[model samples]
Target: MSGERARILVVDDEKVIRDSCTRILTTEGHIIKSAENGNIGLEVFREFHPDLVLVDLKMPGKSGMDVLEEIESIDPNVVQIVITGYATVSSAVDAMKRGAYDFIPKPFTPEEILLIVGRGLEKRRLLLESEALKVEHERIRRNMISLVSHELRAPLAATVQYLEVILGGMAGEIPSEAKEMIVRCDIRLQEMLELLRKWLNLATFDSPKMAEHFQDISLSDIATESIELMKSLAEEKKISLILETSKDLPPIKGSKVSLEEIFNNLISNAIKYNKAGGWVKVILYGREEEVWVEISDNGSGIDEEHLSRIFDEFYRVDGRRNAPIKGSGLGLSIVKKMVDAHGGMIDVESKFGEGTTFRIGFPKFFQRQKEG
Candidate 1:
């Protein structure tokens, strides 16, 4: 009774027992309420939301087990203790099966009643704490989604408006160099948008009811398309783009869209971080059970310390000070997530001031001789 006092409800058909129990609990500095029968007790339970409930098994209107079921339906976490006069071992076992926290005989001492009530109150406190933690976690997740949405949308919107003007010829007689610059900007914007979409999709996939789509597709074709998509950006920077893929490469079983996105992000990053007039090489090789793809670039390589956290969301190697080469910092993270979704593995090898290489391994699904 020295601990925190809890709100308790006493339910019994006997007026004397109900009143006496309420008096004893109230004297101990605990808030108490009394109900004549189980039906009335249920009404009081909804209104009071007591932390603990004490119900007599032999009731006139509704049985104690009935009351326990109703209370559990209202809030399963509410602690329930059963009291009975003709207490048999079987009856006590039955009460526990119906969700009662504990049982006490009618002729029990005040000390016994207080001890059982205290235990029930402690259980209630733990249930409330668990519910609070779950709610807090959900709130933080929502906040993260809101922040990422606002931060990613602004740059994408600007890029879209610029492209619309150029494509509409609203900016009349644009120079070839200026058009190419706009297109490069457009590509970066598209990359940012794709990263955002991947993050959102990953969240959806984490739900238990979501399904993943997998299919058999040619890894060589997917890699080639990704390389061609970023070829313009490489040309603009005077970077040489090379693709070395075996003609007899095996197909991979996975989501083609996800695979394409992963390759696109890696290849784009290789171009983005490469030095002017440097080179990017993409190679594909088929093994017995799996296929390997590597994208390597001659550029400013990632530092050893920062490489570990490169896959973290919104994590950038260069701070905001590096405006000319700044990125949204979600490309590699998205790539890693997509690879994981496909049940594949991806790794990065880099040395500072030298270059970086990203290697991905996929399970082979098609016969290499089909194309021949």
Candidate 2:
């Protein structure tokens, strides 16, 4: 009657009420199911899966309020209308609170009931349409990200390689001045490439697919490799890299590459922001159900105001001291996404100008768990 016919369930203790609703809705081409009480209504709901439900209060056993609450948990999308003899302001308020779209008083005219039912059906239709639009928008966004990243990656990577070749003296010995310029260009281009990669990683990440790749991995080993990879950068800034791990730690379920990226991004940031001769410490151990990794650095710690947004994409502290530090601002964002995909938790603690510590906990691998 609203737009298209919908499956409707009518639940009431009185035979006349249920028959009346079924006859009215059925004549409008809607399919109908009738239940005598709240218990029967819930049973029919699970199997019939109606798009709308008309529930009556003052039942002998299970009350309509109980039905509304249970239906909300089962499927809040289904339009719910309460039929009540009490019909007091308090009763209506209580029904709405339990997820009723509207209430029809006892002995209502056929026209009044029809009007309420029509409005409920329209509301359900709009809600469904809104949900569909949101899903579509997300799909389009993901596609656009993939297309742009793929288009830019190849050309940018080639330009960086060509610059590296020249800097390596393959193009012929160049003047010292020209060499310095090419080196700077190479560095900037590389940073752009890194940004794009991280951005693509964040946008295209598939949590379900990631879970498929999960395997028992040692966090200590991943941290060690990341430390090794970042050694030269730490050396340039004269920052000391230290690793302290408890032995015989339990394995964590995760994709090795994803886990490695988490450690690398955090460790690199620590070194980049640290003052000369500062120390970056990585500590790993096992707690009750989680394998924990803590990366702490004696550096220019983040401000209190910026901590909340530190994981936001393209967000930076913008402090004068950090002006020289270059990043895509997507590193922490990507780290957080990957950790969530692994069913892990991440937290940060910092005191401005003092230091910062990032703690991540990965669920310990168990035999019953097949995927993340």
The best candidate by lDDT is: 2
What lDDT tens digits, residue by residue, belong to model 2 across residues 137-247? 999997889676767887889888899889889999999999999998888788788888888888888877778868989888999899999999999999999999999
Model 1 compared with the native: what TM-score?
0.57
Residue 197's lDDT in candidate 2: 88
Candidate 1 residue 80 C-alpha distance from true site, Å: 13
For candidate 1, give the lDDT of residue 59.
87
- lDDT tens per residue, model 1, 1-372: 137888899999888888878877887889999899888899999999899999999888799989998888778889999999988999989989989989999887788888888888888888999999999988987787766667666557767887978856897888889888888888777766766766665544441121134567888889889878988998998999899998888777777777887888888888888889899999999877889999999888999999889988888898675567867677777788777665568889999989999998877753222111
Q: Rate the local accuracy (lDDT) of all candidates.
A: 0.82, 0.89
The Cα RMSD in angstroms, rounded to one decimal, for candidate 2 relative to the true structure is 6.0
| lDDT for 293 (candidate 2) | 94
**Model 2, residue 91: displacement in angstroms?**
16
